[model samples]
Target: MPIHGIGIDILHVPRLAALIERRGLSKLASRILSPVELDAFCSLTSQSENKRALAANERGPTEPIVRFLGVRWTVKEAAYKALYPLRPTWKELTYTSFDAKKGLKPELVYASLSPDTTPAKLHVSASHDGEHIVATVLVEQG
Candidate 1:
Protein backbone atom coordinates (compact mmCIF):
# COMPACT_ATOMS: atom_id res chain seq x y z
CA MET A 1 0.00 0.00 0.00
CA PRO A 2 2.67 2.57 0.54
CA ILE A 3 5.90 3.45 -1.07
CA HIS A 4 8.84 1.82 0.64
CA GLY A 5 12.11 2.68 -1.01
CA ILE A 6 13.41 4.80 -3.85
CA GLY A 7 16.68 4.41 -5.74
CA ILE A 8 18.36 6.60 -8.28
CA ASP A 9 21.59 6.08 -10.19
CA ILE A 10 23.71 7.67 -12.87
CA LEU A 11 26.04 5.74 -15.13
CA HIS A 12 28.81 7.15 -17.27
CA VAL A 13 28.75 5.88 -20.84
CA PRO A 14 32.52 5.76 -21.01
CA ARG A 15 32.48 3.54 -17.93
CA LEU A 16 30.07 1.15 -19.59
CA ALA A 17 32.15 1.14 -22.74
CA ALA A 18 35.18 0.27 -20.69
CA LEU A 19 33.35 -2.56 -18.95
CA ILE A 20 32.13 -4.00 -22.24
CA GLU A 21 35.61 -3.83 -23.65
CA ARG A 22 37.21 -5.47 -20.65
CA ARG A 23 34.64 -8.07 -19.55
CA GLY A 24 32.72 -8.54 -22.77
CA LEU A 25 28.96 -8.27 -23.23
CA SER A 26 28.26 -12.01 -23.21
CA LYS A 27 29.54 -12.45 -19.70
CA LEU A 28 27.75 -9.39 -18.45
CA ALA A 29 24.55 -10.48 -20.13
CA SER A 30 24.75 -13.97 -18.63
CA ARG A 31 25.34 -12.58 -15.18
CA ILE A 32 22.56 -10.01 -15.29
CA LEU A 33 20.02 -11.14 -17.82
CA SER A 34 17.07 -13.55 -17.87
CA PRO A 35 16.01 -15.53 -20.94
CA VAL A 36 13.29 -13.07 -21.79
CA GLU A 37 15.68 -10.26 -21.12
CA LEU A 38 18.22 -11.86 -23.36
CA ASP A 39 15.67 -12.11 -26.12
CA ALA A 40 14.73 -8.49 -25.77
CA PHE A 41 18.35 -7.45 -25.57
CA CYS A 42 19.11 -9.41 -28.67
CA SER A 43 16.22 -7.86 -30.52
CA LEU A 44 17.29 -4.37 -29.59
CA THR A 45 20.96 -5.04 -30.10
CA SER A 46 20.61 -6.88 -33.39
CA GLN A 47 18.69 -4.20 -35.19
CA SER A 48 21.28 -2.55 -37.40
CA GLU A 49 18.86 -0.36 -39.25
CA ASN A 50 17.62 1.14 -36.05
CA LYS A 51 21.14 1.65 -34.81
CA ARG A 52 22.08 3.42 -37.99
CA ALA A 53 19.13 5.69 -37.72
CA LEU A 54 19.96 6.53 -34.13
CA ALA A 55 23.57 7.00 -35.08
CA ALA A 56 22.57 9.31 -37.89
CA ASN A 57 20.90 11.41 -35.28
CA GLU A 58 24.15 11.44 -33.26
CA ARG A 59 22.77 9.04 -30.67
CA GLY A 60 24.60 6.12 -29.19
CA PRO A 61 26.08 3.63 -31.55
CA THR A 62 23.93 1.43 -33.73
CA GLU A 63 25.52 -1.64 -32.18
CA PRO A 64 23.21 -3.66 -29.97
CA ILE A 65 25.92 -4.37 -27.45
CA VAL A 66 26.07 -0.73 -26.49
CA ARG A 67 22.31 -0.31 -26.32
CA PHE A 68 21.81 -3.64 -24.60
CA LEU A 69 24.39 -2.92 -21.95
CA GLY A 70 22.96 0.52 -21.39
CA VAL A 71 19.51 -0.96 -20.89
CA ARG A 72 20.84 -3.71 -18.65
CA TRP A 73 22.55 -1.22 -16.38
CA THR A 74 19.43 0.90 -16.13
CA VAL A 75 17.31 -2.14 -15.26
CA LYS A 76 19.84 -3.29 -12.72
CA GLU A 77 19.71 0.02 -10.92
CA ALA A 78 15.92 0.13 -11.11
CA ALA A 79 15.54 -3.42 -9.80
CA TYR A 80 17.96 -2.66 -7.02
CA LYS A 81 15.89 0.33 -5.98
CA ALA A 82 12.62 -1.56 -6.19
CA LEU A 83 13.79 -4.67 -4.33
CA TYR A 84 15.77 -3.02 -1.55
CA PRO A 85 12.58 -2.35 0.38
CA LEU A 86 11.59 -6.02 0.35
CA ARG A 87 15.11 -7.15 1.28
CA PRO A 88 14.93 -10.16 -1.00
CA THR A 89 17.88 -12.10 -2.32
CA TRP A 90 19.70 -10.51 -5.23
CA LYS A 91 18.61 -13.24 -7.59
CA GLU A 92 14.97 -12.89 -6.63
CA LEU A 93 14.40 -9.95 -8.94
CA THR A 94 14.74 -10.53 -12.64
CA TYR A 95 14.89 -7.95 -15.39
CA THR A 96 12.45 -8.62 -18.24
CA SER A 97 12.87 -5.83 -20.77
CA PHE A 98 14.49 -2.46 -21.42
CA ASP A 99 13.22 -0.31 -24.23
CA ALA A 100 12.54 3.24 -25.26
CA LYS A 101 9.24 4.86 -26.19
CA LYS A 102 10.88 6.87 -28.95
CA GLY A 103 14.51 7.94 -29.18
CA LEU A 104 14.45 10.12 -26.11
CA LYS A 105 13.90 8.03 -22.96
CA PRO A 106 14.72 4.61 -21.58
CA GLU A 107 12.22 2.27 -19.88
CA LEU A 108 12.73 -0.75 -17.70
CA VAL A 109 10.46 -3.74 -16.88
CA TYR A 110 11.23 -6.40 -14.33
CA ALA A 111 9.74 -9.15 -12.12
CA SER A 112 10.34 -9.57 -8.43
CA LEU A 113 9.91 -12.87 -6.58
CA SER A 114 9.49 -13.98 -3.00
CA PRO A 115 8.03 -17.06 -1.35
CA ASP A 116 5.82 -15.17 1.06
CA THR A 117 4.43 -12.50 -1.22
CA THR A 118 3.60 -11.85 -4.84
CA PRO A 119 5.79 -9.68 -7.01
CA ALA A 120 5.52 -5.99 -6.26
CA LYS A 121 5.17 -3.22 -8.80
CA LEU A 122 8.40 -1.62 -9.96
CA HIS A 123 8.41 1.71 -11.77
CA VAL A 124 11.53 2.50 -13.77
CA SER A 125 12.58 5.60 -15.61
CA ALA A 126 15.84 6.07 -17.46
CA SER A 127 17.52 8.55 -19.79
CA HIS A 128 20.82 9.36 -21.46
CA ASP A 129 22.58 12.70 -21.59
CA GLY A 130 25.37 11.73 -23.98
CA GLU A 131 27.86 11.71 -21.15
CA HIS A 132 25.92 9.68 -18.57
CA ILE A 133 22.87 7.49 -18.20
CA VAL A 134 20.37 8.31 -15.45
CA ALA A 135 17.70 6.14 -13.84
CA THR A 136 15.14 6.51 -11.10
CA VAL A 137 13.24 3.65 -9.51
CA LEU A 138 10.17 3.61 -7.30
CA VAL A 139 8.84 0.66 -5.29
CA GLU A 140 5.38 0.25 -3.86
CA GLN A 141 3.59 -2.44 -1.90
CA GLY A 142 -0.09 -3.10 -1.71
Candidate 2:
Protein backbone atom coordinates (compact mmCIF):
# COMPACT_ATOMS: atom_id res chain seq x y z
CA MET A 1 0.00 0.00 0.00
CA PRO A 2 1.15 3.52 -0.69
CA ILE A 3 0.63 6.22 1.90
CA HIS A 4 -1.60 8.94 0.46
CA GLY A 5 -1.49 11.35 3.40
CA ILE A 6 -1.57 11.64 7.15
CA GLY A 7 -3.20 14.21 9.38
CA ILE A 8 -3.29 14.79 13.07
CA ASP A 9 -5.22 17.23 15.22
CA ILE A 10 -5.22 18.08 18.92
CA LEU A 11 -7.96 20.09 20.56
CA HIS A 12 -8.30 21.56 24.02
CA VAL A 13 -11.38 20.21 25.73
CA PRO A 14 -12.35 23.55 27.19
CA ARG A 15 -12.51 25.20 23.78
CA LEU A 16 -15.15 22.77 22.62
CA ALA A 17 -16.87 23.06 25.97
CA ALA A 18 -17.06 26.79 25.53
CA LEU A 19 -18.44 26.46 22.03
CA ILE A 20 -21.05 24.04 23.28
CA GLU A 21 -21.76 26.44 26.11
CA ARG A 22 -22.39 29.27 23.67
CA ARG A 23 -23.97 27.48 20.71
CA GLY A 24 -25.61 24.56 22.52
CA LEU A 25 -25.01 20.92 21.69
CA SER A 26 -27.79 20.63 19.14
CA LYS A 27 -26.53 23.55 17.09
CA LEU A 28 -22.92 22.51 17.40
CA ALA A 29 -23.86 18.98 16.47
CA SER A 30 -25.53 20.21 13.30
CA ARG A 31 -22.41 22.14 12.36
CA ILE A 32 -19.79 19.52 13.04
CA LEU A 33 -21.28 16.04 13.24
CA SER A 34 -23.45 14.11 10.80
CA PRO A 35 -26.80 12.67 11.83
CA VAL A 36 -25.18 9.37 12.72
CA GLU A 37 -22.45 10.99 14.78
CA LEU A 38 -24.96 13.19 16.53
CA ASP A 39 -27.03 10.14 17.38
CA ALA A 40 -24.02 8.31 18.76
CA PHE A 41 -22.93 11.31 20.80
CA CYS A 42 -26.41 11.65 22.18
CA SER A 43 -26.56 8.01 23.15
CA LEU A 44 -23.13 8.05 24.73
CA THR A 45 -23.86 11.15 26.76
CA SER A 46 -27.33 9.99 27.66
CA GLN A 47 -25.82 6.95 29.29
CA SER A 48 -24.55 9.37 31.90
CA GLU A 49 -27.77 11.32 32.46
CA ASN A 50 -27.67 10.80 36.19
CA LYS A 51 -24.05 11.84 36.35
CA ARG A 52 -24.75 14.71 33.95
CA ALA A 53 -27.49 16.06 36.19
CA LEU A 54 -25.22 15.89 39.21
CA ALA A 55 -22.37 17.60 37.38
CA ALA A 56 -24.50 20.12 35.53
CA ASN A 57 -25.83 23.25 37.11
CA GLU A 58 -28.20 25.74 35.46
CA ARG A 59 -25.58 25.61 32.68
CA GLY A 60 -25.71 22.35 30.82
CA PRO A 61 -22.50 20.35 30.36
CA THR A 62 -20.96 17.14 31.56
CA GLU A 63 -17.55 15.52 31.13
CA PRO A 64 -18.71 12.85 28.75
CA ILE A 65 -20.49 15.37 26.56
CA VAL A 66 -17.48 17.61 26.30
CA ARG A 67 -15.08 14.81 25.51
CA PHE A 68 -17.41 13.28 22.96
CA LEU A 69 -17.79 16.54 21.09
CA GLY A 70 -14.11 17.23 21.34
CA VAL A 71 -13.17 13.85 19.92
CA ARG A 72 -15.54 14.30 17.00
CA TRP A 73 -14.16 17.77 16.35
CA THR A 74 -10.57 16.62 16.43
CA VAL A 75 -11.17 13.58 14.26
CA LYS A 76 -13.01 15.56 11.59
CA GLU A 77 -10.32 18.23 11.54
CA ALA A 78 -7.64 15.62 11.14
CA ALA A 79 -9.51 13.87 8.37
CA TYR A 80 -9.87 17.16 6.54
CA LYS A 81 -6.17 17.77 6.80
CA ALA A 82 -5.34 14.30 5.54
CA LEU A 83 -7.42 14.90 2.46
CA TYR A 84 -4.99 17.62 1.49
CA PRO A 85 -4.61 18.94 -2.08
CA LEU A 86 -8.19 17.85 -2.50
CA ARG A 87 -8.77 20.05 0.55
CA PRO A 88 -12.45 20.65 0.14
CA THR A 89 -13.67 23.44 2.35
CA TRP A 90 -15.29 22.40 5.62
CA LYS A 91 -18.69 23.38 4.31
CA GLU A 92 -18.18 21.25 1.22
CA LEU A 93 -17.06 18.29 3.24
CA THR A 94 -19.23 16.52 5.75
CA TYR A 95 -18.63 13.57 7.97
CA THR A 96 -21.52 11.48 6.79
CA SER A 97 -21.40 8.83 9.49
CA PHE A 98 -19.50 7.36 12.40
CA ASP A 99 -20.13 3.83 13.48
CA ALA A 100 -18.72 2.26 16.60
CA LYS A 101 -18.42 -1.20 15.14
CA LYS A 102 -17.20 -2.76 18.38
CA GLY A 103 -16.29 -1.24 21.70
CA LEU A 104 -14.85 2.25 21.07
CA LYS A 105 -13.68 1.63 17.50
CA PRO A 106 -15.12 4.14 15.03
CA GLU A 107 -15.35 4.15 11.25
CA LEU A 108 -15.74 7.42 9.35
CA VAL A 109 -18.02 8.07 6.40
CA TYR A 110 -17.68 11.16 4.28
CA ALA A 111 -20.06 12.83 1.87
CA SER A 112 -19.45 15.19 -1.08
CA LEU A 113 -16.22 13.53 -2.06
CA SER A 114 -14.09 15.12 -4.72
CA PRO A 115 -14.55 13.49 -8.10
CA ASP A 116 -10.87 13.18 -9.02
CA THR A 117 -9.69 11.22 -6.04
CA THR A 118 -10.89 8.78 -3.45
CA PRO A 119 -9.10 7.11 -0.60
CA ALA A 120 -8.45 3.42 -1.08
CA LYS A 121 -8.16 2.93 2.63
CA LEU A 122 -8.62 5.05 5.70
CA HIS A 123 -7.65 4.56 9.32
CA VAL A 124 -8.62 6.73 12.25
CA SER A 125 -7.49 6.70 15.82
CA ALA A 126 -8.56 8.98 18.63
CA SER A 127 -7.75 9.52 22.28
CA HIS A 128 -8.78 11.94 24.98
CA ASP A 129 -7.20 12.93 28.24
CA GLY A 130 -9.12 15.03 30.69
CA GLU A 131 -7.68 18.18 29.15
CA HIS A 132 -7.27 17.42 25.44
CA ILE A 133 -8.47 15.23 22.63
CA VAL A 134 -6.25 14.01 19.81
CA ALA A 135 -6.99 12.19 16.57
CA THR A 136 -4.81 10.90 13.77
CA VAL A 137 -5.80 9.77 10.31
CA LEU A 138 -3.85 7.78 7.74
CA VAL A 139 -4.93 7.53 4.15
CA GLU A 140 -3.78 4.88 1.74
CA GLN A 141 -4.06 4.67 -2.03
CA GLY A 142 -3.66 1.76 -4.32
Candidate 3:
Protein backbone atom coordinates (compact mmCIF):
# COMPACT_ATOMS: atom_id res chain seq x y z
CA MET A 1 0.00 0.00 0.00
CA PRO A 2 1.17 3.53 -0.72
CA ILE A 3 1.86 5.82 2.22
CA HIS A 4 0.13 9.16 2.43
CA GLY A 5 1.22 10.55 5.79
CA ILE A 6 1.19 10.03 9.52
CA GLY A 7 0.35 12.31 12.43
CA ILE A 8 0.66 12.01 16.17
CA ASP A 9 -0.41 14.07 19.16
CA ILE A 10 -0.07 14.00 22.92
CA LEU A 11 -2.28 16.04 25.22
CA HIS A 12 -2.16 16.76 28.90
CA VAL A 13 -5.43 15.87 30.57
CA PRO A 14 -5.16 18.72 33.03
CA ARG A 15 -5.07 21.28 30.21
CA LEU A 16 -8.29 20.01 28.68
CA ALA A 17 -9.94 19.60 32.06
CA ALA A 18 -9.22 23.23 32.77
CA LEU A 19 -10.84 24.29 29.48
CA ILE A 20 -13.91 22.23 30.27
CA GLU A 21 -14.10 23.81 33.65
CA ARG A 22 -13.76 27.32 32.25
CA ARG A 23 -15.84 27.14 29.08
CA GLY A 24 -18.32 24.50 30.22
CA LEU A 25 -19.00 21.12 28.62
CA SER A 26 -21.76 22.05 26.17
CA LYS A 27 -19.78 24.78 24.44
CA LEU A 28 -16.59 22.78 24.17
CA ALA A 29 -18.35 19.61 23.07
CA SER A 30 -20.26 21.42 20.33
CA ARG A 31 -17.13 23.07 19.00
CA ILE A 32 -14.97 19.96 18.95
CA LEU A 33 -17.13 16.90 18.47
CA SER A 34 -19.03 15.85 15.38
CA PRO A 35 -22.70 15.07 16.04
CA VAL A 36 -21.95 11.38 16.30
CA GLU A 37 -19.02 11.92 18.61
CA LEU A 38 -21.10 14.13 20.80
CA ASP A 39 -23.69 11.41 21.03
CA ALA A 40 -21.07 8.87 21.97
CA PHE A 41 -19.62 11.20 24.54
CA CYS A 42 -22.98 11.77 26.10
CA SER A 43 -23.59 8.05 26.21
CA LEU A 44 -20.26 7.57 27.94
CA THR A 45 -21.10 10.21 30.51
CA SER A 46 -24.46 8.61 31.17
CA GLN A 47 -22.84 5.23 31.58
CA SER A 48 -20.26 6.63 33.91
CA GLU A 49 -22.98 8.19 36.00
CA ASN A 50 -24.78 4.92 36.42
CA LYS A 51 -21.58 2.98 37.12
CA ARG A 52 -19.95 5.49 39.38
CA ALA A 53 -21.95 4.46 42.41
CA LEU A 54 -21.37 0.78 41.79
CA ALA A 55 -17.64 0.72 41.21
CA ALA A 56 -16.27 3.76 42.96
CA ASN A 57 -12.94 2.12 43.55
CA GLU A 58 -12.09 0.96 40.03
CA ARG A 59 -12.80 4.25 38.30
CA GLY A 60 -11.62 7.64 39.39
CA PRO A 61 -14.19 10.28 40.24
CA THR A 62 -13.09 12.48 37.34
CA GLU A 63 -10.53 10.70 35.18
CA PRO A 64 -13.10 9.11 32.89
CA ILE A 65 -14.54 12.45 31.90
CA VAL A 66 -11.12 14.02 31.55
CA ARG A 67 -9.72 11.10 29.57
CA PHE A 68 -12.68 11.00 27.19
CA LEU A 69 -12.32 14.61 26.17
CA GLY A 70 -8.55 14.39 25.98
CA VAL A 71 -8.62 11.33 23.71
CA ARG A 72 -11.13 12.91 21.33
CA TRP A 73 -9.12 16.10 21.15
CA THR A 74 -5.87 14.26 20.53
CA VAL A 75 -7.34 12.03 17.83
CA LYS A 76 -8.88 14.93 15.94
CA GLU A 77 -5.63 16.88 16.04
CA ALA A 78 -3.72 13.87 14.79
CA ALA A 79 -6.18 13.37 11.93
CA TYR A 80 -5.90 17.03 10.98
CA LYS A 81 -2.12 16.84 10.94
CA ALA A 82 -2.18 13.66 8.84
CA LEU A 83 -4.14 15.53 6.20
CA TYR A 84 -1.84 18.53 6.48
CA PRO A 85 -1.46 19.64 2.86
CA LEU A 86 -5.17 19.29 2.22
CA ARG A 87 -5.89 20.94 5.51
CA PRO A 88 -9.23 22.57 5.94
CA THR A 89 -9.54 24.69 9.05
CA TRP A 90 -10.34 22.62 12.11
CA LYS A 91 -14.03 23.45 11.95
CA GLU A 92 -14.28 22.53 8.28
CA LEU A 93 -13.00 19.06 8.88
CA THR A 94 -15.85 17.52 10.85
CA TYR A 95 -15.52 14.39 8.78
CA THR A 96 -13.44 12.38 11.15
CA SER A 97 -15.87 10.39 13.28
CA PHE A 98 -14.88 7.33 15.26
CA ASP A 99 -16.23 3.91 16.19
CA ALA A 100 -15.10 0.81 17.99
CA LYS A 101 -13.53 -2.05 16.09
CA LYS A 102 -14.12 -5.71 17.00
CA GLY A 103 -11.65 -5.98 19.81
CA LEU A 104 -12.81 -2.64 21.25
CA LYS A 105 -10.18 -0.77 19.25
CA PRO A 106 -11.12 2.65 17.94
CA GLU A 107 -11.60 3.23 14.21
CA LEU A 108 -11.59 6.52 12.33
CA VAL A 109 -14.35 7.21 9.82
CA TYR A 110 -13.72 10.06 7.43
CA ALA A 111 -17.02 10.99 5.84
CA SER A 112 -16.40 14.19 3.90
CA LEU A 113 -13.46 13.42 1.67
CA SER A 114 -12.50 15.16 -1.56
CA PRO A 115 -13.99 13.74 -4.75
CA ASP A 116 -10.69 12.74 -6.31
CA THR A 117 -9.69 10.73 -3.29
CA THR A 118 -11.08 7.33 -2.52
CA PRO A 119 -12.90 7.09 0.80
CA ALA A 120 -10.34 8.04 3.43
CA LYS A 121 -8.81 4.92 4.86
CA LEU A 122 -7.39 5.74 8.25
CA HIS A 123 -5.56 3.68 10.85
CA VAL A 124 -5.88 5.03 14.37
CA SER A 125 -4.58 4.16 17.79
CA ALA A 126 -5.05 6.00 21.09
CA SER A 127 -4.12 5.57 24.72
CA HIS A 128 -4.51 7.46 27.98
CA ASP A 129 -2.83 7.29 31.33
CA GLY A 130 -3.76 9.36 34.38
CA GLU A 131 -1.78 12.35 33.16
CA HIS A 132 -1.95 12.23 29.36
CA ILE A 133 -3.67 10.96 26.26
CA VAL A 134 -1.89 10.34 22.96
CA ALA A 135 -3.05 9.31 19.51
CA THR A 136 -1.62 8.48 16.11
CA VAL A 137 -3.15 8.54 12.66
CA LEU A 138 -1.99 6.91 9.43
CA VAL A 139 -3.64 8.30 6.31
CA GLU A 140 -3.58 5.89 3.41
CA GLN A 141 -2.62 6.99 -0.10
CA GLY A 142 -5.13 6.22 -2.79
Candidate 4:
Protein backbone atom coordinates (compact mmCIF):
# COMPACT_ATOMS: atom_id res chain seq x y z
CA MET A 1 0.00 0.00 0.00
CA PRO A 2 1.08 3.55 -0.67
CA ILE A 3 1.66 5.95 2.16
CA HIS A 4 -1.42 7.92 3.10
CA GLY A 5 0.43 10.79 4.69
CA ILE A 6 3.89 11.99 5.59
CA GLY A 7 4.73 14.02 8.66
CA ILE A 8 7.87 15.65 9.93
CA ASP A 9 8.48 17.39 13.22
CA ILE A 10 11.36 18.82 15.21
CA LEU A 11 11.46 19.18 18.95
CA HIS A 12 13.76 20.48 21.67
CA VAL A 13 14.52 18.03 24.45
CA PRO A 14 14.71 20.48 27.30
CA ARG A 15 11.37 21.98 26.39
CA LEU A 16 9.68 18.60 26.30
CA ALA A 17 11.31 17.64 29.57
CA ALA A 18 9.95 20.76 31.22
CA LEU A 19 6.48 20.06 29.91
CA ILE A 20 6.56 16.49 31.19
CA GLU A 21 7.87 17.62 34.55
CA ARG A 22 5.15 20.17 34.98
CA ARG A 23 2.27 18.12 33.64
CA GLY A 24 3.38 14.70 34.82
CA LEU A 25 3.77 11.54 32.72
CA SER A 26 0.25 10.34 33.32
CA LYS A 27 -1.27 13.51 32.04
CA LEU A 28 0.84 13.58 28.93
CA ALA A 29 0.43 9.87 28.46
CA SER A 30 -3.30 10.06 28.75
CA ARG A 31 -3.55 12.98 26.40
CA ILE A 32 -1.23 11.71 23.70
CA LEU A 33 -0.50 8.10 24.35
CA SER A 34 -2.04 4.64 24.31
CA PRO A 35 -1.24 1.79 26.69
CA VAL A 36 1.51 0.51 24.40
CA GLU A 37 2.85 4.01 23.96
CA LEU A 38 3.02 4.56 27.70
CA ASP A 39 4.80 1.26 28.16
CA ALA A 40 7.39 2.14 25.52
CA PHE A 41 8.00 5.56 27.09
CA CYS A 42 8.37 4.14 30.57
CA SER A 43 10.64 1.38 29.31
CA LEU A 44 13.08 3.92 28.00
CA THR A 45 12.77 6.18 31.02
CA SER A 46 12.58 3.77 33.93
CA GLN A 47 13.18 0.15 33.00
CA SER A 48 16.08 -1.32 34.96
CA GLU A 49 16.63 -4.22 32.55
CA ASN A 50 16.91 -2.01 29.49
CA LYS A 51 18.95 0.51 31.46
CA ARG A 52 21.42 -2.10 32.55
CA ALA A 53 21.76 -3.46 29.05
CA LEU A 54 22.38 -0.02 27.64
CA ALA A 55 24.78 0.85 30.45
CA ALA A 56 26.92 -2.20 29.78
CA ASN A 57 27.83 -0.63 26.46
CA GLU A 58 30.40 2.16 25.99
CA ARG A 59 28.16 5.24 25.74
CA GLY A 60 26.90 4.60 29.28
CA PRO A 61 23.34 4.81 30.56
CA THR A 62 22.34 8.44 30.97
CA GLU A 63 23.15 9.88 27.55
CA PRO A 64 21.78 6.94 25.61
CA ILE A 65 18.62 6.92 27.66
CA VAL A 66 18.13 10.63 27.19
CA ARG A 67 18.64 10.39 23.45
CA PHE A 68 16.34 7.40 23.26
CA LEU A 69 13.59 9.27 25.07
CA GLY A 70 14.07 12.33 22.89
CA VAL A 71 13.81 10.27 19.74
CA ARG A 72 10.76 8.47 21.06
CA TRP A 73 9.06 11.77 21.86
CA THR A 74 9.79 13.09 18.39
CA VAL A 75 8.44 9.89 16.85
CA LYS A 76 5.25 10.25 18.82
CA GLU A 77 4.74 13.77 17.55
CA ALA A 78 5.45 12.70 14.00
CA ALA A 79 2.98 9.84 14.32
CA TYR A 80 0.36 12.27 15.56
CA LYS A 81 0.92 14.53 12.58
CA ALA A 82 0.66 11.65 10.16
CA LEU A 83 -2.62 10.53 11.64
CA TYR A 84 -4.17 13.99 11.64
CA PRO A 85 -5.62 13.69 8.14
CA LEU A 86 -7.16 10.32 8.90
CA ARG A 87 -7.86 9.53 12.52
CA PRO A 88 -7.55 13.04 14.05
CA THR A 89 -7.82 11.71 17.56
CA TRP A 90 -4.71 11.17 19.66
CA LYS A 91 -6.52 8.48 21.60
CA GLU A 92 -6.73 6.33 18.50
CA LEU A 93 -2.99 6.07 17.98
CA THR A 94 -0.33 4.33 20.01
CA TYR A 95 3.36 3.66 19.65
CA THR A 96 4.74 0.27 20.58
CA SER A 97 8.52 0.47 20.35
CA PHE A 98 11.56 2.40 19.15
CA ASP A 99 14.50 0.29 18.13
CA ALA A 100 17.90 1.40 16.94
CA LYS A 101 19.16 -1.29 14.61
CA LYS A 102 22.23 0.90 14.08
CA GLY A 103 23.35 4.15 15.59
CA LEU A 104 21.03 6.98 14.58
CA LYS A 105 18.84 4.62 12.54
CA PRO A 106 15.65 4.03 14.43
CA GLU A 107 12.70 1.82 13.63
CA LEU A 108 9.43 3.01 15.14
CA VAL A 109 6.61 0.58 15.75
CA TYR A 110 3.06 1.77 16.25
CA ALA A 111 -0.64 0.96 15.79
CA SER A 112 -3.56 3.19 14.88
CA LEU A 113 -7.27 2.60 15.34
CA SER A 114 -10.11 4.45 13.69
CA PRO A 115 -13.81 4.07 13.08
CA ASP A 116 -14.65 1.91 10.06
CA THR A 117 -11.08 0.61 10.10
CA THR A 118 -9.43 -2.15 12.05
CA PRO A 119 -5.86 -0.91 12.61
CA ALA A 120 -3.26 0.54 10.33
CA LYS A 121 0.51 0.40 10.24
CA LEU A 122 2.43 3.45 11.41
CA HIS A 123 6.13 3.83 10.78
CA VAL A 124 8.36 6.48 12.33
CA SER A 125 11.97 7.48 11.92
CA ALA A 126 14.04 9.82 14.10
CA SER A 127 17.37 11.60 13.92
CA HIS A 128 19.17 14.14 16.05
CA ASP A 129 20.80 17.28 14.76
CA GLY A 130 22.72 19.19 17.42
CA GLU A 131 20.24 19.82 20.27
CA HIS A 132 17.11 19.12 18.25
CA ILE A 133 15.43 15.88 17.30
CA VAL A 134 13.83 15.36 13.90
CA ALA A 135 11.25 12.71 13.06
CA THR A 136 9.37 11.45 10.02
CA VAL A 137 6.13 9.51 10.10
CA LEU A 138 4.61 7.47 7.30
CA VAL A 139 1.12 6.05 7.50
CA GLU A 140 -0.02 3.20 5.29
CA GLN A 141 -3.57 1.96 4.90
CA GLY A 142 -4.10 -1.75 4.59
State in Å the error of residue 58, model 1.
22
lDDT of 1 by residue, 1-142 (tens): 7986678878877787777667866576666676666676667655754645544224434444675567557657766766664564333445444436545433344444545665666777767767677777777764
Q: Using alpha carbons, what is the TM-score of model 4?
A: 0.61
**Highest lDDT among the candidates is held by which one?**
3
> Candidate 4 — which residues are off by over 4 angstroms?
47-69, 96-113
lDDT of 4 by residue, 29-125 (tens): 5666556666765665567445465433334335444455566667767876776655445545544444366434344544444356545577777
lDDT of 2 by residue, 1-142 (tens): 8888899999988888888888877778767766666677677666776555644346676777777778778887998888676664444433333456744456654554567666446688888877988988887763
- Model 2 worst lDDT window (10 residues): 89-98
* lDDT accuracy of residue 102 in candidate 2: 48
What are the TM-scores, per candidate, against the unseen true structure? Answer: 0.69, 0.76, 0.77, 0.61
Clashing pairs in 3: none
Q: Each prediction's Cα lDDT score?
A: 0.61, 0.70, 0.72, 0.62
Judging by lDDT, tell me the better candidate of 3 and 4: 3
Clashing pairs in 4: none
- Residue lDDT tens for model 3, 10-39: 998888877887787667877887777777
